[model samples]
Target: MEKREHWKSKFGFILAATGGAIGLGNIWRFPYITGKNGGAAFVLIYIGCCIIVGIPLILAELSLGRRSQRDAVGTFKVIKPGTGWFWIGGMGVATGYLILSYYSVVAGWTIGYFFESLLGTFRKMGSPQAVASYFDTYSASPLKAIGFHGFFIVLCMIIVIRGIQGGIERACKLLMPTLLGILLICIIRSVTLEGSLAGLTFFIKPDFSKLSTQAIFEALGQSFFTLSLGMGAVITYGSYLTKKDNLASSAVMITFLDTFIAILAGFAIFPAIFAFGLPPDQGPGLVFRSLTNVFNAMPGGAVFAPLFFFLLIIAAVTSGISLLEVITAYFVDERGWSRRKTVLTMGTVSFLLGIPAALSFGRLQGVHILGKTPFSFVEGLTANYMLPLGGLMISVFVAYIWGGRKAIDEVKVGNPVFITGRIWVFLLRYICPFIVAQILLFGVLSEFTSPRVISFSEILRYYLGIIDIVIAAGVIIGGAIYIISIKRAKRREG
Candidate 1:
């Protein structure tokens, strides 16, 4: 058997993992979501969720990967042997591939926009409408959209085929630092604009009153979503780590950097968002449409606009590499394919499959699945259902199936100092799984509801009522009791 590829340094592992977490959402969605929900109020909620909800779940997933020393599918198969648990890993791999198909297409648009920005394509865009029109025109063009998608996927393919230590580690070492540097530059420029203080105040001040029923769930979703949880990206990345690294510390580092970059991205955009007096709740095109307008309107925007878009493209590339790595790792580790063969085959197939999604905004515009466009349907299904289900299953497997002692042992693999094991287990066993299950259940129900576009808060307020709250309370309290009982029983046995 070929030796399993491992990261050369702790920094590489953290960078690779953080690269996976920092994606298009961190750049586009986070800032806008923060602006709309309660500015800094929602950010605090998001941070809290990241701590309790994200860290535990990802640590569990990473522990599984490192312990099993295999891809997601291979990990379950090795650990459980004869059980159906491997399907969780299977689901992760499949979900990653499906997500990548469309995700690459969107990533491609960022690259396309990067070039256009450099070329000063949007220099003359006077209003948000003009920028919106520019996005519509490019996205609706079948040739342009597919071409860009193909380009982005190919770039990822090249990196993955070069193997872990050489390509992924090296790319992230370059990419993550560059991404951070660019964000800092953008934040400085944005915060210094004439009307930027209002934006700063709005982002920095936390007013709890903005907490609505939807905002709570939105924060929950973002916390998980932003971290690349539930999708096996962490699992896949973790499989490559050296056995000497501490899982807990690595997870914390990745989470800290991911959250930091997200907040930095918010600073970069929210200040501009307030300066332009644009609605913070503007939808997904915030980057392509609204931000371009901000760039066109800002001082020295012609140059900075391109730099910002370039950073956006790199952000997309880093995350896309992770998504692609999830898929590539499975084939290479489980199916025994050569890295080159797997990369080429999967890359070709995924790029071809992505063509439909590329056209979804253009040629396939009107087509809908469960009331979502082809592209949106793919995203909604994976993010809401597959990812959450995968995360829930990972939590259950680690906390219950594998047993608490075993999990603690896994977390303690290399580190001499370890205090988070017990609390992390509690969160994974009790809080994370139940909450993710709620996300999964709600995600499914959303498809049938009228207009099919109600918020999580709305879903909870009306149809579900206090049932979600009651369930969550029951799960947390019951979980704490059960864990205590288990430990006590073990102590008595000893």
Candidate 2:
């Protein structure tokens, strides 16, 4: 087997990992989630979740990766030669592949919007309606959207093909600082708007009254999903680590930078959101539509319009490349494929897979498997089920199969002071799996049932009739497998 590649420097790995964590979701989703949930109180819950759930998972992923020095799937196999543990990594690889398919589609939109911003398209849209129409026109354009989608894939392919140090790390090192600088300029301009203070106040002041049970799960989901947790992406990145790198500090820095950038994004956007009198809960189009109007009204509209959109594209690309690496890492490590072969094969396939999602807004708008856009349908599958399941399996596999002592030893590689053992293990053993299971159930159940408890009977009917079928089948098949295995073991002994 070919020798594995490692990060050239610890800082480079951190930046790359941070770039992965800081994606389109951080830019677009996090602020809206915070605003819609509990404002600053939601932010606090989110922060707590990051500390309790997100950071611990990050450490687990990094420790697992650096110790095994393999792709997500390979890492599980390395620890336990023949077991269901490998499926955990396989699920992670599939999650990364599945998410990236549609993720690249969104990244492509950012790219198109960047050019639109450069042409001052957003600057002329003086009203939210006009901005919305503009976005609708652009989004509904099949040729333009798919063109950008294909282009984004090719661009990511370039970086992934270059090998770790030369490709992924190099792009992130440049992208991170540049993204921060552009964001700072936008924040400065946004805060200077007349009513921006109200928005800032809205964002900073805690309102514990708004933190509901659903919002609690929302915070956990956001924190878990935001940091690229539960996906193989982090573990794939971690696989490139050298022995000298500290997994704990790297995970902490990645979390800190990712969270800081997310909050900074809130500061930058909320001021504009309130200052312009836009609706804070406008769903996915908030950034592209309403914020475009805010950009038009700002004094530095001409400059920051392009700058902000450029920032969006940069963030998306950095994230897109990182996800691409997960699939690339698997093929390269486990299949004896070269970097170029893996990148081309996986990148092309992902781009092709994304076609339906890109077309979902226009060509396939009405096409639904179970009353959801193709994009949204896949997003739900991966985010709700696949990603959380991957995270749950990882926590369990590390805590039980690898054993607590060995897991800690992998984590304690660079630290003489290993004090995080007790709590981390406890969370890994119990809390994380349980939280993830709750997230999966709630995430799905919310779609079919109202958050209100007005009709318990209706929910129970649906749960028993539909949900229980999947559960029952799983149990039945699992029991059959166990019985068959036991009988086979007895035969072998005889």
Candidate 3:
């Protein structure tokens, strides 16, 4: 095999990894999730989840990658050789590819909106209704949707094709700082607006009465998903680390930077929403619609409008590079293909796969599979099942199969006095996997059941019937493979 690339510096790895963690979800979904889920209480719970679940997994993945110095799939194979455990990494690579397909379509919207705001498009709209209608019209345009989607893919391809240190590390060094700088500017302007204090109060004040079980689950889920865990992105980035580098500190710093940016995103958005007397829980529409109205009415609307969307574009590109790199890493490591061939071939195919999702907003909006539109179905498949399953399995593999003691030994190579080894292993063996399993079940069950459950029978009838069967079959198949792989390994050992 050819030599592999490593990150040139620890700082580059930190920025690149954190940039992979920070994405459109931070800018749009997180603020809305926090507002509706008991504000500061939810935020606190989220931070705890990060410490308990997110950071441990980050350590596990980073250790696994650095020890093997291979792609996600190859890392598993390197450690367990001829075992079914490598399929976990295969699932991760597949998950990244699946997510990148539809994710790029939405990332494209950010770029399209950035250009639109830059060109003074929102200035022409007089009312919130008109602004919303404009978004609907733009989203419903097949030509524009596919055009921007292809554009975003091409941007990612260019960055990922340049090799690791020169491409991903270099681009993130520029993009992440710029993203934070623009975000600070937006927050300053947002808070200075009259009546903005209402938003801040709502965001910072936590009411225990408002906190629900569902909200707690939401916090746990966000903490896991927000850090780009279980999707091969972290593992792929970790593959470039050196033995001298501290995995524990690197994971914590990446988590800290990601969480800090997410909270800052709330400050940038919530103040503006409350300043304009708009509802904070507008869900996903808050960014495209309500924010447009806020921009139209604000003092420096034209200037800040472009700045905010530009920030979104930057966040999208930074995250998009990592997703594409996940796929690129697989082919380069496993198939021995050149980075250029892998990136171009996989990038083009990813774009083609996304065309259907792009069209789902326009021509295929009415079509439904299993009571969901094409876009929603794809989103649900990955978010609700693949990601959480991947996370849960990784924890189990590291704790039970690879042995947590061995994993920590790998982690402690750089930090000789690493103190959290026992606690981390315990969490991985018991607490973390259970929490991720809850997230997985909630994600799957919530799709078929209402948020307000009135009876046990309701859950049994709506939630458990089909999903339970699917989960059971998966467990059985996975168990069989594990048993077989282990028996084979023992035979080889003998």
Candidate 4:
């Protein structure tokens, strides 16, 4: 097998990782979740979770890859020889493919909106009904969505085929900074609106009374999504990290940058919504319709609207590059294929997979997986189930089977502070697994407990939901306890 290469410079790694962490999840999903939850209170808890859980998991993933010097599949095999943990790597690759399939479709929306904003189409739009019609006409058109998705996926493949330094790093070096600069300008403009202060207050002020169990779960889910955790995306990127790189500091920097972008995006989005009297919880429609209207009606509407969407497209594209890279790397490293072959094959597959999502708006609208909506069902399964399940496996593999204390030490390398103390172990052994298990169980229960008029054809949906939760809970608890017991025995023997 040809030996894979590490990033030539630290900045390259940072840019690529930051690109992965910052995406539509920040601009599109984060704001709505914040608005729907207790705003700033949820934001605060989310930041806390990002620091405690996100940073540690990131370091662990990067350290594992750097130490093993292999992509997701080979990384586990190399680190803990003969262990079945490599299956986690396989899951990561599959998750990446799943992510790209739907994500390309969403990215298509951003691209379409970018052009619309540039054309000043929103200026003539006055009523919410007009906005609804605009979206209905454009967003539901299968050909338009497919064309943009195909374009976005091809762009991603071009980057991956160019190899790491030439394609991925070079693009991020220009795109990430440009993304931040555009966001800051938008934030400044957003805060100048008449009702901006109220928007800020809504986002910053913690209303404990508004927080619910569902809100807490939502926060957890957002944190996972925002950081790109549990998708094996990070682990695949981590494979390119050099041993000299400081995983702890790098993880912290990426986390901080990701959080900053999310908060800044809130500042850009919410004030505009408030000023225009638009509902904040418009879900994905918030970006497609609501924000487009805001840009249209703003002072420098023509110029700023296009610029905002352009920035959004760049953010989405950078993240999509990471998603594509995960599967591409798996093929190249594990299957002994050329980079071009890997990218072309994966890109074609992803493009074909995305068609269902793209067509969900038109001719394929009748195709229903479960009784629920098609897009929603796909998003729920991947985001809610596969993501957390992947995270659980990662935590167990790093904290128990592979390296354990050795892994901690590797993460702490080149840093003055060490995380190998009992406190770190306690969280890895107890808190992380416990939180993940709860999320898994609640996710399952919520699916069943929700009122849905069911038919015999849909009976399997409810049964699978129950079975998924049971198995997930059992695996998480079983793995955590088993690992802790082993550590105790090792200590006793010493």
Best by lDDT: 3
Compare the candidates by TM-score and give the number of the best one: 1
Q: Model 2 — TM-score against the truth? A: 0.90
- Candidate 4 global CA lDDT score: 0.79
Score candidate 3 by lDDT.
Answer: 0.86
Report residue 312 deviation for candidate 4 (angstroms). Answer: 1.4
Worst 10 residues of 3 by lDDT: 463-472
What does the lDDT read for residue 151 in candidate 1? 95
- TM-score per model over all chains: 0.92, 0.90, 0.91, 0.89
Candidate 2 lDDT over 209-240, as tens digits, reads 76555566677788888899878999999988
**Taking the tens digit of each residue's C-alpha lDDT, what string does model 1 give over 1-494?**
45788999998889989988998879877887776797888887688678777888888888888988999899898878998989999999888889889988888888888888888888866656787789889999998999999999999988888989899999999998999999999999999988888888888998877667567677778887889887888888888876788998888888899999999998999888789887777768778888888888888998888888888888888888888888888988888887888889999999988888999988898988877788998989888889888888889998898877787887787875465567778777877776787778777766765554555536565444245446546655765786677778778989
lDDT of 4 by residue, 1-494 (tens): 55676786888889889899899999889998888876888887678667656776787778877877778888889988887879988888888788889888888988988887777677777775687668878867988989999999998988888888889988899899999999998998999988888788888888877765456567777888878888778888888887678887888899999999999999998888888787777776887777777776778878878888888888888899999988888888889988888899989999998888887877677888875545666777888788888887888877777646887777666554553334455556655676676567656655763356334314544454345345435644765676687678778989
Q: Tell me the tens digit of each residue's lDDT in model 3 across 171-274.
A: 99999999999999999999999999988987788777776656666777788778888999999999999999999999999999999999999899889999
C-alpha lDDT score of every prediction, in listed order: 0.83, 0.83, 0.86, 0.79
The best-first sequence of candidates by TM-score reads 1, 3, 2, 4
Candidate 2 has which clashing residue pairs, if any?
none
Off by over 4 Å in 4: 372-374, 416-421, 449-494
Answer with 2 or 4, whichever has the higher lDDT: 2
Model 4, TM vs. native? 0.89
